[model samples]
Target: MSRIGKRPVELPSGVSASMSGQTIEVKGPKGTQTFTATDDVTIAIDDSSVTVSPRGKSKRARQQWGMTRTIVANLVHGVQNTFKKELEIQGVGYRAQVQGNVLKLNLGLSHDVEFPIPEGITITAAKPTELTVEGHDLQQVGQVASNIRDWRRPEPYKGKGIRYKGEYIFQKEGKKK
Candidate 1:
């Protein structure tokens, strides 16, 4: 049995969830997001709480029970409280700027890198060095953050380049003189 699956997810106010066939739509103050849940998992909402259950007692159903519930719970949280990913730009002249919907990144490369923002995602910079990605969908938020970080990963030598918030990088020692 899945412990998390058995627990009921309490929904916050100002969030609405609807199901149409395999797709589930969630609307909230931030924005609206939708997902296609697996057929084996069933979701129901009752009085500001969402419950997830498996269709049968099969092995696959049991295994997927908790996973499905977690996904649903995240969706509920996403709609109510926006998910954010913070990235820091290191090295001289390395910075990111938001131009309309495009993110122009200068990471010491031959040319400036332009990454187009996807729908339902917002990017904000607290400072010239820090970039924040916010969205309702967990997958989309994570993917965009990873894509930008991949452009210039932190090096062990100097720990320079873009990295996730609180991410650790072990510094390598330089050669002896």
Candidate 2:
């Protein structure tokens, strides 16, 4: 049995949930988000909680049960509060800044990289070397942070690049005679 799937997702006072077919929508003070589950699971919405159950004893159904439950929980939480990701640049001249709908990055590359911020997401530069990505949807916020980290990932030799706040990069020793 899946212990995670057994737990119901509780809706806060300002949050509401509705389901249509395979899709579940959660609305709260921050915003609304929706998730579509596979046919292997059945979703139920109670007065203050949501539950997901497997349709059968098959392996696929069992897999979907836990995943669907987690998705529903994420939707409920995301609608109530905004998700955020932080990044730190650790190079000599590397920096990041948000201008309108685009993020300008200077990662010691030949030229600056201009990344256009997608809808429903906001990127902010608290300092020249610190960036914050925020969105109501957890998936989108994480994706944006990953994409930003992809550019000039931390090097094993010098550990100089953009990285998550607490990420650890293993350093390699320099060549010696």
Candidate 3:
């Protein structure tokens, strides 16, 4: 029995959810999001709460039960509020700036890297070294932050690159003399 799956997801005030076959759609102040559950699980919404139940006593059904419930919960939360990811540039010349619909990154590379911001996601640079990614979809926000960080992952030796805020780099010893 999955503890988390047993708990129904409650819909906060101003948030609404509807189901169509296997798909569930949640609408709130931020935006609308939908999720389709697999046949291994069943989804039901009642009295401003959503629940997921396994179709049978099978491993796959149990696995899907928990996953589907979490997905529905994420949809509810995402529509009600936005998700954000923060990245920090650690190199001396590394920096980030948002110009129009593009994010310009200077990570000591040969040329400045230009990342085109997607329609639903927003990227902001509060400081040259600090960047924030915001969006209604949690996956999109995290993916955008990861894509930007991939340009210059922090090195083990110098730890110079782009990294998530509060991330710790395991530094290695320098070359022996």
Question: Which 10-residue window of candidate 3 scores lowest in summed lDDT?
Answer: 74-83
Put down candidate 2 lDDT per residue, 1-177, tens digits, no spaces: 999999998888999999899999889998888888999999999999999999999999999999889888888888878889999999999998888999999999999999999999999999999999998888899999999999989999999999999999999999999
**Stretches of candidate 1 above 4 Å error?**
none
Highest-lDDT candidate: 3
Residue 156, candidate 1: alpha-carbon lDDT:
95
Pick by lDDT: 2 or 3, better one: 3
Residue runs of model 3 more than 4 Å from their true location after superposition: none
Residue 161 deviation, candidate 1, in Å?
A: 1.3
Model 1, position 30, has a per-residue lDDT of 74
Query: Local error of candidate 3 at 136, Å?
Result: 0.9
lDDT of 3 by residue, 60-150 (tens): 9999999999888888989988889999999898898999999999989899999999999999999999999999888889998999999
Superposing every Cα of model 2 onto the true structure, what RMSD results? 0.8
TM-score of 1: 0.88
